[model samples]
Target: MTHDLLVIGGGINGCAIAREAALLGLSVLLVERDDLASHTSSASTKLIHGGLRYLEQYEFRLVREALGERERMLAIAPHLVHPLTFVLPHDHAVRPWWLVRAGLWLYDALGFDSSLPRSRSLRRDDTGYQTPLRQAYRGFVYSDAWVDDARLTVLNAVDAADHGAEILTRTGFELAEQAGDHWRVTLSDGRTLEARAIVVAAGGWTTQAMTAMGVPPRGKLRLVRGSHIVVPELFEGDHAYILQQPDRRIVFAIPYPGGTMLGTTDVAVEDPSDARISPEETQYLCDAANRYFRRQVSPAEVVSDWSGIRALYDDGAGSAAEVTRDYVLELHDKGAPVLGVFGGKITTARALAEDALGRLAPVLGFDAHPVSRARVLPGAMIADIETLARQVAERWPFLDPHDIDRMARAYGSRLIELLDGVDSVRDLGRALPGGMTEREARFLHETEFARAADDVLDRRTKLGLGMSEEERRAFADWWATAFPAG
Candidate 1:
């Protein structure tokens, strides 16, 4: 099959690029070596905000651009992406109030048309009682957005398919070479595809893809591994906490699903694809969380832990945490030009996709379409989240309220379509061999193209973190029978 563009890597950048390209009337094919978002994209801190700490690195432009994109995504996908308040617990080890205040000022100023609430000071004695904090600490609360990173990636692919783009996950690219006016690419599974232009959005393995295409690197990518750990529920409210440890590196304790999430440690990596969390990294996260919280969560409390590699630009930085998280596009003219993407944040992927489309105008021979910044995502075809929540609640009053809210957040207006004709929680279908239900599993498999049990359990619904090992095995067995490949 010949496509106008063949996007390698169905991670966030590739999915976004393919969706934008397809929406602009170009034929696109997105190929992923494994399941979509099986790597860094899914393992993100899962926030959709401009990096507040980037202000310290003097990354004003990157922070500003990401902030703008944050609001745009929130407006378009209010269900999946929503405003989240963060408490930056202050201490003597960290910067003083004046310095933190200045940072907040810059953060608020850099962001425009903000849909979220602005930052404010909080009295330690007031709401501090609600948090798991020491008596000596006071803090400021600020606004940012949180996202279901994996779902965001999947929704983009689904949207691309809606616009006639062919998205194939677990389809590895074997080789690429110029065949006359086009590039002929071979997939590991024996599928051959032809395309006029190519996009390498392969996140961690971006450099590998360039090498495979026989294209020399125009720029370098710095791989940085970041790790996060999940613990039992810590707080009751919807707010997130960013606590500074004695080591000076800050970690977050955010509300995730029913539990609380503590993360992440940044360590420079020699290889992007091979980076994984070490024993020390896990210890570091637990110790960081223990610094501020009155109730200490030990290493044993960690239900699940994961890591992601940041495909950062090779900026001259001594520390991985200090590396700039900005991105750039490199175009090569072997046959049709191949656009290589390097270093982008989850919050800014949509804007990056738009910019990528602008760059491909001449290559694809299509006029750059007007921006679709305000357009809602496919499942986000609704005005508000409350209505969607109420609609889902009406169907299953017995279902755990928290789970219902999570599904509404993950699936949006499509939650109704996903649970169609179900009367009670039991009618949602047979219970999964695990904590999830068969209806949710089928929704992921039949609708979202989840081919593997881990894709549904880990990324699609996060049941892998919550379920027991025996439960996981049973679920895997059931999934294998339900979704066997032809």
Candidate 2:
């Protein structure tokens, strides 16, 4: 069967584009080489902000667009994307107080329609609740949003599937050739598909994908590696810290579920697969955090670390940090129409998808209307997540409050659907470590395209961090026995 669109890549942008196209009445097929969001999409700093530091580079356009998208995402996915206050302590040596205040003012002005509170100045006493600073200094608190990045990608894929798009995970696009008016594509699994148009949103692999498809590279691609480290909690509050480094770069210390998430270093890499956080990068992050907070961190304190490669459109920038985070869509009409996606951030993926479809509309002969602007993602139908969690706790009085909270945050309104017809803890099936049950695991495998234990414990949820070594071994044994390798 011929599809109207064939999307190659299961990252947030590709999934979002597929959902948007499917909702626009197009028959779509999306194929992912590995699990959805297993790469760069999962390895993010996990913030939905306007890139406040970008204002320094005169990237006002990107910041404004991202700020608007941030508002829209918060409105639709309140459960996963909620407001997070950022405390930027003024370091006179790094940036002057007046300059910081001006930037905050501009940020607030740009996000005029934002639901979050505007930025505010804080005295030393006012900042006492956060990690103790080495010295007394003024600070500013501004608003942004946090997200379960992997879950966001999965939700988009789920929504696309619900809207009649065929999603194929663990399937690789091997080749493509023009056949009449459509492109005949071959998959690694020996399956074939025909589509009038193809969208390549392969993240770091964009250049490789285009090269493999015999399409000439439209622009020079630079692979910049961004790394993050997770450490034990450093503060008491939910508010995050944005620390300015001597190099004029910024590192964020966010309040993660199990600890403080600190990151990220921008280093130019040669290969996309070489995205491992180096020892020097880890030390740099620790030193950056130690320079601000009185609670010093060492490489030994790192519980876990991850790195993602950004395939950016090289604009002759001097440093990787100076490269543009904005996305570029290149349309090639040589064979069947194909669109190659360049650089983009998670916060602007929805907007990027909208722009991509608008550009492809003329080539594909379809009128693309804005459909996802007011639509809510799957599992985000609940308006107030706290109220829904309370209701779930009330319904299941025997369940642990912590378990209920985790489930509600991970599944949102879909928590009910996950636990449908189940009563009591035993009904949930063998309780794995971190409150996950066999029932929930099976649901993720059957519905959410979770293939392995890591897919469940690491990406889909961070329950792995809370699991004991023995508990993880037991879960692995059970998973292998239940769903062995194909």
Candidate 1 C-alpha lDDT tens digits along 1-486: 688999999889999999999989889999998899999999999999889888889999999999998988888888788788898878855677888889998899888578688888866565643456755556788999888899899999998998999988889888998887689999888988789988999987888898888886688888889898888777768889988777667898999864788888888878777657788888888788777777777788777788999898787888888888899998886566789999998998988899998988976678987556877787788778778788768766777777777788778888888877877767777777656778888888877879999998888777677677898889889888877781
The RMSD (Cα, Å) of candidate 2 is: 1.3
lDDT comparing candidate 1 with the true structure: 0.84
Question: Poorest 10 consecutive residues of model 2 by lDDT?
Answer: 123-132
Looking at model 2, residue 63 earns an lDDT score of: 95
Off by over 4 Å in 2: none
Give the total clashing residue pairs for model 2: 0
lDDT of 2: 0.89
Per residue, candidate 2 scores C-alpha lDDT tens digits across 312-347 of 889889999999999899998766888999989999
Give the CA lDDT, 0 to 100, for residue 326 in model 1.
91
